[model samples]
Target: MAQRMYIVDDDKSIRVMIKNIIEDNDLGVIIGQANDGEIAYKQISSIYPDIVLIDLLLPSLDGIEIIKKVKNEINHDMIFIMISEVSSDNMITEAYEAGIEFFISKPINVLEVVTVIKRAIESQNLRNVLNQLKNTYSIDSRKNVTAPITNSSRRNTMKIYSELGITGESGCNDLANIIEIIVNERKTNNHFNKYNMKEIYLELNKRFYSENSIKTIKAIEQRIRRTVIVALNNIANIGIEDFSNYKFEKYSSVLFDFSDIRLEMDYIRGKSKQRGKINIKTFIEGTINLLKD
Candidate 1:
């Protein structure tokens, strides 16, 4: 069956353009559309679309309110993608917390819209598969199963590093070691963020080096930073070539700030001279999040 979608933007032209893109790309079928939040909520509740592309600001109520209502009141599975011109982080965070899967920034870029919608559909399908699997399997059957070493977190970390184009870097091992250490600590504390970068580096130095020297700690930091920079550049290059690339879509926003990714992408395109800033802590936290997911 074709995936069902609904558009809830106030602008007629925006709705038309998105509809055209959906049909042109054979992405999905638009089941309904609305120019007001109250109407949108009613329509979405009635039709139960597989995905909804909704504007942030609308008549009657706002996008966040509508999403919250539907999620709270209706017992249905749906994906919500917010369309907005707002750049306020607080509003965006609220939208995310309200259960939005993605954001389509306005004035919309066609590639971005198409890519995001495709990703949404992909996510919806994956959820359906997982649901089916859950229904088909028994908890007792799963209890005795053990994942192979090849499927371990360490291997998964290496696979992700390879996808980010950092597997060959000198600090790849150090990065993996750091993640392992964090994972081990998480088994007890669970609040991995409580440990700072300095403490992490100190732990690594104590575990691997003969002497607890500041020089070794600095070297470790520099090496990991350089490796992370290489991963950023690789992601930027992938984005420049194809914004819809799965790796680019998945890691760009999670591993680093989207703004930094954009900066790196622009620099690669010769549209900007400034390079992206690397936040090592953000990268580490993001990686751990990915691993957990």
Candidate 2:
């Protein structure tokens, strides 16, 4: 079944533009539209759209006020998205507390709106699946003491990392195994079911690396290492395939500046090009800019 969406905005042109853009992108069925909050409330109560897109500046009642009112009186199941030109941090925070799932700031690009909506839909669908699985499983930790996950979990995790282009991810395969072994050891000894991040990190390092973990923090080191590795890989393999014409044109500039990953990739073509050592910066910065939200 196609999902339903409702749009609420005071300007007719903005409303029309959004509806057309969404329809053009084949996003979903636009169930209804409202010029103000009052009309929006009525349509929402009667039609029950699966998602609601609201502009902050409306005619009578504003979008934020509408969100609060609807939550107080109507159902809270539908996802809410706040669209605004203003960058009022406090208002955005308050709207978040009131249960807006996401935001798209204006001047609204249609492409961005589509991306946000798709991401939100994906999240909601995943949540629904998780809830269904929880109801179906009725997990019993004591049933088989320490039975391993039956191949399915491993396949699923690998598939996920692969889909996200993280096949070369180091920690997911190695450090995580170390941590899992530590947890299993604790469980076998009948230890408590609680462990802090620092304690877990220390235990993992002590067990696997033969060195005490840092006392200062949580999974910060793990995240940094994994992210840096990913950044390095992405920058090196930035262009998925090499076009014969553009290989030495567009990518040559990228390679000339960042010799880290490109230099390594060069060695893969031993017969085609001469060999060279590839060493990415121990501390570099441009990589982070590419992966920023």
**Which candidate should be chosen as best, given TM-score against the real structure?**
1
lDDT of 1 by residue, 32-80 (tens): 7899999999877654677899999999989999999877666345799
Clashes of each: 0, 0
Best by lDDT: 1
Candidate 2, 1-293: lDDT as tens digits: 23567899887887788789778888766767899788888767655565788988788878888888766555335678888886888988888888789898887798889899887777655654453333222233446333333233344433433433444333333322333444456559844245444554564445334234343122324432433344333334443354343423433333235454455356333422332232222222121111221
lDDT of each: 0.80, 0.55
**Clash pairs (backbone) in predicted model 2:** none
- How well does candidate 2 match the true structure in TM-score terms? 0.45
